[model samples]
Target: MRRRLIIVLCLAVVLVVAARLVMVTRDLPAQLTGAHFEGLRPEPNRLRAFLHRMPKGGDLHTHLSGAVYAERLIAWAIADGLCLDPAAMVILSPPANAPAERPCGDEAKVVPIADAVAGWRGQTTYDLLVDALSMRWFLPTPAVPSGHDQFFSTFSKFNPATGGSDWQRTLARTAEMTVDQLRQYQAENVQYAEFMVTLLEGEDRRRLGEAIGSEREPKAMLAALEQSGITAVVTQKVEELRALVARVDEMRGCAADRTRPGCGVQFRYIAQVNRNGAPAEVFAQTAVAAALARAAPSIVAGLNYVGPEDYRAARQDYRTHMRWIGFLAADVPVALHAGELWLGLVPPPDLDFHIRDAIETASARRIGHGTAIGFERDMDGLLAEMKRRGVAVEIALTSSDVILGVRGRNHPIRTYLSAGVDVTLATDDAGVSRIDLTNEYVRAARDHGLGYGRLKRFAFAALEKSFLPAADKQQQEQKLQRAFAAFEQEVTDDLAWPDWLAAFARALLPRRG
Candidate 1:
């Protein structure tokens, strides 16, 4: 009886200690931020400030080409002495054998970009070009009736400024663009990014397509590519990318003692394959992308299919494209632009199977846009499979709303979360959408009613689902944890009363009388 009594006393003591420990380690920051978030809905400025200070982990679905602002592109064009077609708001190459006095040629139809930007119609031309390059103040019209058309067409419109014809100039422009994006991300406290970029171009790209001509069998095509000295080309492309990275580092002053914020942020690339090309051309690009990924796994992390998914070539060759990706990317990782469609955008049958085929056939580790998840057949089953396989969906809220008209309750973000599928917020084309990562988090909280805790999960999900290596991922996870802790403490500190005010209140309190 005495021994039993002693044992019960010991159990009681242990329970008391455990309770004390829980109290000591309670998350005061999370609690404080939760209260702050609850009160922020009524104030837009405060809401933006709060989320802006919050740490965003990474953006995994960004397109490099579409991420540059129109103003910067125009500046580059002016520096190159390029011409502009004011009617189309498109940049044109300088004519050959052109006189130095008129570098853009003496044609009345085209004027120098510099002249257009500073002439009598300067402001008007500038505004039109900026609006044309992005979705700002857009409305349906006779020429470009759909948001979809306007969004995709912006790429070709600004292609000349992005170095459409000159390979050396293209490299320099790409490096400058990358540095610009990284610096922007750093200002918002984003720790990492995986940019989707197209590395092959010009004669090299043409030669690879010819070598892969008319080959239907995946293995045979891969074998032919191997025999066609594609390795040398891949080597050259890899070196070019390395040079680009070095240029980005130099521009950002990464090697200096006093470095820019962007110097600390980690970045990787995913080679892009254009889906609007001919079958052989598409296959050739895919093979080259796979080779690039394999050759430089550290720099080129993976491959993705870009271009509008509903294009004539993309829709007709969807299955074949999947097969190509499935076969060529056996060992490499893939993220596909699947189910970016909507009911009115395409025929009903088109939406039914895209997400499924991408997951089941192409082995996509991540799905971009995924706006048509509701229209996809076996919605519940597909969600289940995605959950089972750990496939993450990259949700671009602003881009989807602007380009596909998918937002609010109509978006499948809630559905995916309810079904236990992992989802992360991204900026599909930050410049094109005129938004950043913070804008996406704000949209999630304001539009979808996501609370602080749930939004935090989305930030962490981006890092966990990134294609970064395991060791690098772990390092980034640690950095994210530290950033959140500091951010939450700042919020709590803001809520605290001033020490002098507290003393004054204490002095005014009633005495023990």
Candidate 2:
């Protein structure tokens, strides 16, 4: 009887020890990470943890047309019962303004994986239709057609494809896609936390009409666009985007149900107005974003104008446009794509002045594609001013980085980072670039050699540079700090559970599950 009793006791003790061992090993990564936050291991998973833990500030830069994922676009197209030509794999359009010929010819569209990859790049052209979009120009000669030209010219190609459609249903599908992106992004992020949610709306389309500058009925186009409820349309679009975010928050609840906080990561809208668009359109979208900012919470923030700054009217009235932006900046947050340039597009004087003008005149809160900052006139003076204003910059790795990837290493990210320019890495267009926020994170780690500490700092910088207002930002930043500190403390604590439990078992246990 005594021997049997001893065996039972021994077995119980062994089981208890085994349980403890399992718990410790299962959480080994977390424990190790907690214990040595600074000396964190170097690997993708470690990098992921750093990214996940870091409070992403915001993605202040993204273009709507390009921001749409290609897969979703294909799915949307397929759902709409849009047919494609087998030969070219481009979606056919109804004969509204087309010559009797079908856009995709009369064949079924194919998604050959190899071809899709190649076509996704500018290495080869797919059968995407060309229309006089607010963003693209039909070229008579190939003189101006470089990769840069083709790159900037795509919005015009596809924007018309979406025009005059049932935007509500379209938004419903878009919202669905956004939900997927949010999960995919929660699994990662883009533009970091800012989630630069772009919406193609009223002023931009009309501006496209204006840029086209045809005498062929501007009033009719404006009237039609207005009827389409583009402003109302975009506002609804914001809700759909919110739907995706809500699901992400839901997932957050599921993951960290107890003793955690809400994901206050934000979403900001840039009512994309093309530089090549009509002055009226730019002004209108700017107004829309400003209004939305006042009405919406930290969620709906700001306005921005995108496109190459080399258009005729844009250059002519560049200062005038800045003055308009300055006026709007009083109420609305502004981020502008300034100084995204190549050698021959603009004069040295123009490139020299654009970014500074974007800051001073347009009151850009953040600068997108400040790629030419090194070349701008009084560049140091401007840099000093930018730093003074705390105007963070977004380094779009996918699109702008390609300039560096192929030829000249055109991105100024390293320069910006070194100069204490508040910099965040972003995928400018995931669809166009075939990259995402995760990809950006991976790239930043590998290419830039950013470690966990720095990645955390960069993530923090994104939130700081976000368009979120002062008070909300302060509160969120504090929360982020508290979260980091709390986790760090829990992780690095040397006290074993036995000690903790003996002292405070009842205190630690939840009142209810």
Q: All candidates' lDDT scores?
A: 0.87, 0.56
- Measured on C-alpha atoms, candidate 2 has an lDDT of 0.56
| Highest-TM-score candidate | 1
Clashing residue pairs, backbone N/CA/C < 3 A, model 1? none
Q: Could you estimate the TM-score for every candidate?
A: 0.91, 0.65
Mark the regions of model 2 whose C-alpha exceeds 4 Å error after superposition: 1-57, 85-89, 92-150, 153-165, 189-192, 195-265, 297-299, 310-317, 403-410, 449-451, 482-513
- What does the lDDT read for residue 189 in candidate 2? 31
| Tens digits of lDDT, candidate 1, 1-513 | 999999999999888766644643387566556656766778978898989889989999999878888889889989988889999988898999898888888878788988898967798998998999998889999999988899998998888888887888888888888888888888988989999888777777787778878888888888878888888888888898888888888898877744666886889999999999877778888988998899888889999999999899999999999999999897998999999999988899999999999999999999998999999889999999999999999999999998888889999889999999999999999888888999999999899888777888888999999988899999999999999999988777777566333422332332110
Predicted structure 1, TM vs. truth:
0.91
Q: Residue 408 CA error for candidate 1 (Å)?
A: 0.9
The weakest ten consecutive residues by lDDT in model 2 span 504-513
